[model samples]
Target: MTTKTFLKAGLIGALFSAVAAHSALAFPANMTTDGPTNPPVGHYEFCRSLPQECGSNPGSAAPGVLTREGWKKILEVNYEINQAVTPMTDKEIYGVEEHWAYPDKVGDCEDYVLLKRKRLIETGFSPADLLITVVLQPNGDGHAVLTVRTDRGDFVLDNMRNKVLLWSETEYTYLKRQSEQNSGRWVKLQDGRTVAVGSVSQ
Candidate 1:
């Protein structure tokens, strides 16, 4: 890997590490299933890998697939591909700067962040509004979090839980941020500061 890639990997060691640490990962009570059908898991099972289930069109949908409001409806249901399941207890999902406290979890922090970003784009939100953020959990280590800059302030879509929290309320030390700005545009926002971040359209 290139030097930059290596450094990023080193910094986000917690995010890229293996899966959940325990034998079984738990979701919030709201995430429970009465039978085979469930909210997050059912729709989530469709996209083992995003491109396969959702398609390669990162953020394009012809002319009339889904309206902005319709997209939000879709996002609320299957948050797993992009969101964190709300925790059952009061452990505090976003701990000190680590993507997750343990490795037993399944999806990577980036996976959750990207999934939510993709769904929002697919639905019709301005790509600029969604950012994949990096942070040091209060624990002060490298981790990833998705920050959604909405009309209602920045909200967090964490794999750690289903609760979408406000950005400042997230309580993590900002590190860097990347977002898909209108397809192919990426932004990197560093901690303690907000930068007009973007990458040229490829």
Candidate 2:
């Protein structure tokens, strides 16, 4: 890896080294189930926009083990995309129903997470480690964030914040997430342990 990559990894490692120590309070492993499903239309469009990644093979690494280089790549992609993209809803940007796609100028939460995941995958972070996760905001609005699984636990990369945080710190109720093995697939991520944060039923 290059010097930049090494520095990025070191930064991420320093920022998230505590996660693994606190993993017991994080989302339970049983919450996620496995299955291949259809990709959302906006994700489909985004995939069409980048055919190379859409057709690429999945990563073979064990789920959630954070290497210094991989962790740095995740932080780099998350921070870069969060700073670069202006947040706007699908209605404002596309003028229609909920659409999840990569943004050129402005896009909503889902769009932010999509681009982050795509970039991380492109940067050689395992697709299995990077997941697109959905949650119910405190106000009951449906929201999306990128979940980077690590030995430290699942850290959330949100458009609203530049820092990568454990999912428990985000104040959003866990709903569902993309399957580890495939980008096109999704799985429900709720268990009896989940705390309701909003009135939204998704």
The best candidate in terms of TM-score: 2
List ranges where model 1 is wrong by over 4 Å: 1-106, 179-202
Against the reference, the lDDT scores of all candidates come to 0.41, 0.68
lDDT of 1 by residue, 1-202 (tens): 3333433433323211212221232322111111111112212333443324332234422222323444344336235453233332212344322232222233455545556666666766555555556556665545556665543234566766544554544556554443332322233443332332322110
lDDT of 2 by residue, 1-202 (tens): 4435545555666544555546556455323543444555566666677666554335634565677667667667777787788888778888887776668979888888878877887777777777777778777777788898776567888998766777766687777676776665566665344554322222
Best by lDDT: 2
Q: Relative to the unseen true structure, what is the C-alpha lDDT of residue 61 in candidate 2, on a scale of 0 to 100?
A: 46
Q: Candidate 2 versus the native: TM-score?
A: 0.75
Mark the regions of model 2 whose C-alpha exceeds 4 Å error after superposition. Answer: 1-17, 23-31, 34-61, 191-202
Error of 1 at 95 (Å): 26
Report the Cα lDDT for residue 202, model 2: 21
